[model samples]
Target chain A: MDTSVRSKGTLKLMIVDDSNIIRRRIERSQQIARLEVVGAASNGRAAVEMFRRTQPDVVTMDLTMPEMDGIECVEELIAINSEVLILVVSALADKATAVEAIEKGANGFLCKPFTDRQLNDALEELLSEA
Target chain B: MFKEAEIRTFIEGTTNYFETSAQQSATVGSPYLVTDGNPGAYEYTGVIGVTGARKGVVYFTAPRGMLTVLLMRMQETDTSDENIKDLVGEVANTISGNARRDFGKNFVISVPVVIAHDLEKVTTPHSRSFVIPINWRTHSAKLVVCLE
Candidate 1:
């Protein structure tokens, strides 16, 4: 638990998933007071572009996406902003996929079809690491 | 042909989707083979293409009314056609994605292709497909697994 990374105001959050409903769900399910969503994208390519523009502190990334999957996007985002914290939010339940995302620099993993409480808890844990 | 355990993985996945996402446990009746020409899809179908170790399509077809209620349960106010499509697609994606836990990484699934039309009339590539009946609340839907 490192509190030295962020000063603790409003954390800029980005949602990246191929499903529009998922993006909206994540947007509406925010219970944490510090998390303020900055932007969202449907694919990893757009996510990368948005990340560059908005420079969000945290990103909830989906693994299986259209252009440039999350694995590649994770690598790219880490290269640009090593300090950025990313949580792999995906339906890929295999352990291998989770390991791969973490290996590429994602901070945490939350599986799809998650409950609102589960989502908030994951985000809380993600930020606690910072 | 998939093993019984493999098919069970999908059944568990489908039921788990309802339990976790919808917050209600859906009843999945025993799966039966669709011998008739039609595989029997409802008003809205979310189709996902499978690749890697397996090749075929896995879809979840439900009615507009069912999806609308589902959206409402998820705290979504707008139940537009696009929203309905998104819900159906997400269901298909979640179910297929969860299967990877048992089927491993080779059971790769594609993003959903939502169909608002009647899939009951469409001809499927596979001669035989397994249809898993799902009942939630007063609504009924089908989870069709057509693999080769």
Candidate 2:
């Protein structure tokens, strides 16, 4: 696991979702988790490319996107860097997919319409497990 | 035809989405079945197709006023037409996604299709649509579910 970014005191985060509203919401709520959003992507394809470029410490992913869904993105992200922490923040309510994501290397999963407090708590838990 | 449980699930999804995403509570009115056209015509609508174990369509319709307030509550200062359309689609997607928890993997929701006007003409015909009225912050919108 890459602890260098977390050890630096401020984690570099990336938000990936198809909806602009969702991406902006996560960006606005980053303060709750004390993280810096270094990058964002609207689709999985863009997310993969951005992940390679930004190499953020953590990534918030949304499933059911247009270009590339979250499941595929998670696989690609983990393949690229097994150390990177991926938190699935998606509107998908399927437990099967959530479990699949974990099996595919996602560190955590959170449903949509979450509060800032909930978001902060999830991030804290993910980081703690790291 | 739609099952009572299915309708209840959709209502819960709509309520949860509003409360969490917009920080606004929503009241769901009685659900009624409609067969010819949309229950109530609106300026904007977000439609999503459901496939897999069940085949159907779901949508969220709202007037410009309601959509504007929703956008503003979402921290969007620019309630432009484009933003309103985007907001509507996101709301519908969130609601449908939430329902998947109750419906299980059998419910597969597609990406949202946003309609700015003339929803009645494009709405699916023959299928029975359950129209549920939702009131939020004095503004009103409708959640329509049509299944095969």
Candidate 3:
């Protein structure tokens, strides 16, 4: 395991976002920390499909996706599997959206323009969730 | 096709996007015409295209100095070309997305493009449109919505 990160397992993570910046950030963070980035999707619908195929340990979702959007994705993801840990990573996940995600069964909230530490912390929290 | 409400929503949405994502406190100004497309002092200007109810472009003009500060806030390292480019372009894209969400599913947004504006030579016709300036610290950005 990389000293910067605490895990070295084949734990998969699905990054869902339309912006290349976000996908790259999550992927890069995973690589630097040596985590397995299983898949990525540009929209919510695609993310759902990716989730089923990858069966990731965690999901980093962006709220402002075009087709299905984050809130809807959260709803769908939770309905499909409530045990999955979902961390919203978006600049648009404001107070209302954060509350909405929590209500919809998201594991945690992450405000965008965040650092790798924030990302790591979110994943750790999710991993600890039951 | 852009309505007064749209322009207002765009400005507000853009403001919220930057304020939240960039972690910068934006000094918002009232909406006005873009008398000259070029304003303030900066070497690079980033613009995001907006379509649908209105056919026009939204600019996130940042003086390099301002961009540096924004980059500093967006990431841990102060100097990453990828991060800076992504930060500037994504800022515009995100603001436009927020505005589009308000406009319902009718609007379509284009990829973000950052242009290096020669402050000394760039001339945006005032008659075409005057801009509403939103100053952020040392950097000033404009949100101009020219109706189609």
Cα deviation at B75, candidate 3, in Å, is 3.2
Better of 1 and 2 by TM-score: 1
Q: What's candidate 2's DockQ score? A: 0.70
Best by DockQ: 1
User: What are the lDDT figures for the candidates, one per model?
Assistant: 0.88, 0.84, 0.66
lDDT of 3 at B144: 54
**Model 2 chain B: lowest-lDDT 10 consecutive positions:** B119-128
Q: Write the per-residue lDDT of candidate 3 for residues B1-148, one digit (tens) a residue.
A: 3445557776776667667546666878877654445444346655655566656666566666676787666553634565566566677666665664456444556666666645554333233443567788877777555545
The list of candidate 2 runs beyond 4 A from truth reads A1-6, A32-34
Q: What TM-score would each prediction reach against the true structure?
A: 0.95, 0.93, 0.60
Model 3 TM-score (2 dp) = 0.60
Residue B54 of model 2: what lDDT?
76
Instruction: Quote model 1's TM-score.
Output: 0.95
Q: For residues A1-130, could you state the per-residue lDDT of candidate 3 as single tens digits?
A: 3521134344667899876667876776653243478899989999999888887767888876667888899898888877667888765433565677889888788765565677777777766663
Q: Can you write out model 2's per-residue Cα lDDT over B52-121, one digit (the tens) per residue?
A: 8778788899999998888778777777787788888888888888888988877898989998877555
TM-score of candidate 2 against the unseen true structure: 0.93
| Per-residue lDDT value at A12 in model 1 | 89
Model 1 C-alpha lDDT per residue in residues B70-116, reported as the tens digit of each score: 99889889899988998899899999998899889988898888888
